[model samples]
Target: MTLHIYNTLTREKEVFKPINPENVGMYVCGPTVYDFAHIGNARPVIVFDVLYRLLKTLYPKVTYVRNITDVDDKINAKARETGEDIRTITERTAAMFHQDMAALNAGNPDIEPRATEHIAEMIDMIERLIENGNAYEADGHVLFNVPSMPNYGALSRRNMDDMIAGARVEVASYKKDPADFVLWKPSDEDTPGWDSPWGRGRPGWHIECSAMSRKYLGDTFDIHGGGHDLVFPHHENEIAQSCCANKTDKYATYWMHNGHLMVEGEKMSKSLGNFFTVHELLEEVPGEALRFYMLSAQYRSPFDFTKEGVREAKATLDRFYTALRQHADIEADDVAAPDHFVAALKDDLNTPLAISILHELLSAFNKAPSPQTKGHLLACADILGILQQDVEGWFTQNTAADATEVDADQIMGMIEERKNAKANKDFATADKIRDDLDAMGIVLEDGPGGTTWKLK
Candidate 1:
């Protein structure tokens, strides 16, 4: 199948033909790792994750590289605020990021490089830029000469004049042009620093991705992806530095960017009091529901995340799980994802259309009489990364019980009574008990061993 992606550079959907069909390389800019990742931050993580999965399916081998920005100004600020060591903050936050993304079922990348670990590589790239007259040292800093790369604004489609007007360019005496961005800047005694040709300094934000991507994925890769916010100065600088340093016409064959996310109808911001961390939201909603809600919209469209929207997504997943539970005897066969679903995903990762196809499959599975129908439903769901939980487990894991309120014996007695009602063909009574439990937002699932419950 030919996969097509919307190349941000061209501003059009183009067929994705990898440079080397045998091996595909993809690079995505990762988080700064100073704090918990918000739902907005998760958009790119999950969006690119789907593309990574799709690419692996289509190619013989796919190397997906996502970097960890452990060294940043943000890290410094966080350290000062918490009175903790910078490394400790970065380590803890990175671990939390891994846990949160994993909970959303986003698979790990093949190569996860850290910026601090690749300082040598970044310095080497900077040296090459300096040798090529694309960079210069001034005020103990190395800055990329934006004018050296004529295609600096191609990805963002902003002219240099307009870019300079919009950007809050530091009127540094050292910079040759207002558009020139820092490749490496000197770090003070307190900040993180590493020995470089330009003295003790740290890499600029854009250089980390350029250097890490080159070190792992080579000078030119198949795809580079990130949030839309990164397109302007971050990605544009990456394009200029990589292309200029490596003497390559193309840095990445395709550039994919996911849109911004909003809370309710407004932009999510700290001042708005809607800035939600993934960790905090997980306390209220299951991570699977969050993932489902994210995939409900097309990746490029700005998503409005509302409490009601998440509740609706949870209800949708519950319906799917309920169907699977009812047909536990139905054995699904292992098969490739259906053609229509794959087609939708291949077309620039159209998750909205892909999800619609899944619903259609669900409907067909519900109406079909063949025992194989359940297997087919499951096979389709596997591609979408849902319905992997034990059908009984989903219903039993999150039930209504305050830790200090309920005794083990009481719960056991209720289960026993519910089981007796089911055995005596007293489904009315059995359902009533289930309804009573559900009123507390609890779900029950019966199995060969016994009945289990979970909070809804």
Candidate 2:
């Protein structure tokens, strides 16, 4: 089956058609780089990474661009609170974002443009908008004239009243209309600014993405993606600025958005004590487990992340790894994934269905351990970005708070003692050792290879 994506603009699952099939281009809105990315922020990253992997297989080349906004009001606020240089705070936060995302096995984009580096492009776009009469400079600030665009809320499908209320637009005296949004805002000496036609100012939040995406991926690209929350103002403003400046009716051919993410049963928040950053979660749970757990649900479905669910994800991975370990000597063939597995992903990224197919593959491989069967299992897991770790390392690695309490050497020594007891025909002593390890939250499995231990 061909690839199909749920286009937010059309509100339908349509077949994905690239403008140029030889080289597909995709742009996803990245983090603002003012603070650690929370778990809710991770949904789009993991979701799109799977789509990226699938695209690579279907096309000759795929150019993925994810930007970083280094110059923002949030970064400025953080600098003030810490009494640090704006550049210093932005650099540190950007570095942290990269490291944290890398832990999740998210591949780097082909082009990662920063907002500060693209001031020239942003200034040029704003000038074009002004010349086209889509924007005007007022009170040393350039604002997009929403009334100029007849279909201002085309993508969002909202009326002017709903758009204004939803965006909570500033009703400033300088704005020509209440729905008008900023393209460029004057920045003081303390804040980051660049020389432009209007004055020394910085690009608005929405303008940064418009200029960056156009510079990297043409005026109209294959796919533009982000969290669902961005559909109204952030993405809506981007479409307005890009189409007006470029003189094109379409900013992107396809628009995709992932669903919202919650913690347990409530919205993720620091005040609720449920907010978690990917960095902090990595310490307690394996990164692969988090990736797997996130994929367990369909990308477009609202997800309620829970601690118990994360533990189950880890245990499920253990089952797949154990099967591979039992047939360690078999050399898996390099093979493409089963057709049904790829079809599931092609159908608007049905990751939950794809993952369920993985379980069936696992069961099939266990029943008949062959190079061909193993290859099918590994190939399917590759698309999901799971089951890639070393088999033995997966079992021995420590995770969670309790897993660290015990030592690998200590567990191995006890396993050896039990082995000796069983060899001596002392069943009683062997059972006692097994019970003792069980008391300490350890599970021992005896197979033809020998007894292996893992944290329960």
lDDT of each: 0.85, 0.91
- The clash count of every prediction, one per candidate, is 8, 0
Show the colliding residue pairs in model 2: none
User: Which numbered prediction scores highest in lDDT against the true structure?
Assistant: 2
Q: Kindly list the per-residue Cα lDDT of model 2 for residues 78-193, writing each as its tens digit.
A: 99999999888888988999998887878889999999999999999999999999999999999999989887899999999999999999889988899999989998998888
Cα displacement (Å) at residue 237, model 2: 0.7
RMSD of candidate 1 to the truth, in angstroms, is 2.9
Please provide, for model 1 over 1-456, each residue's C-alpha lDDT reduced to its tens digit, 9 standing for 90 to 100: 578889999999999888899999999999999999999999898888888777777889999999999999989999999899999999999999999998888889999999999999999999999999999999999999998998779989988788876666778888998889999999889998998877898999899999999988998989999999888888988999999999999899899888989998999999989999998888777777888899889898889999999899988998898777766667776667778888988888888888888888788877883556666666666666677677766655552223234343566677788889989999999888888766755556676746766664
Worst 10 residues of 2 by lDDT: 396-405
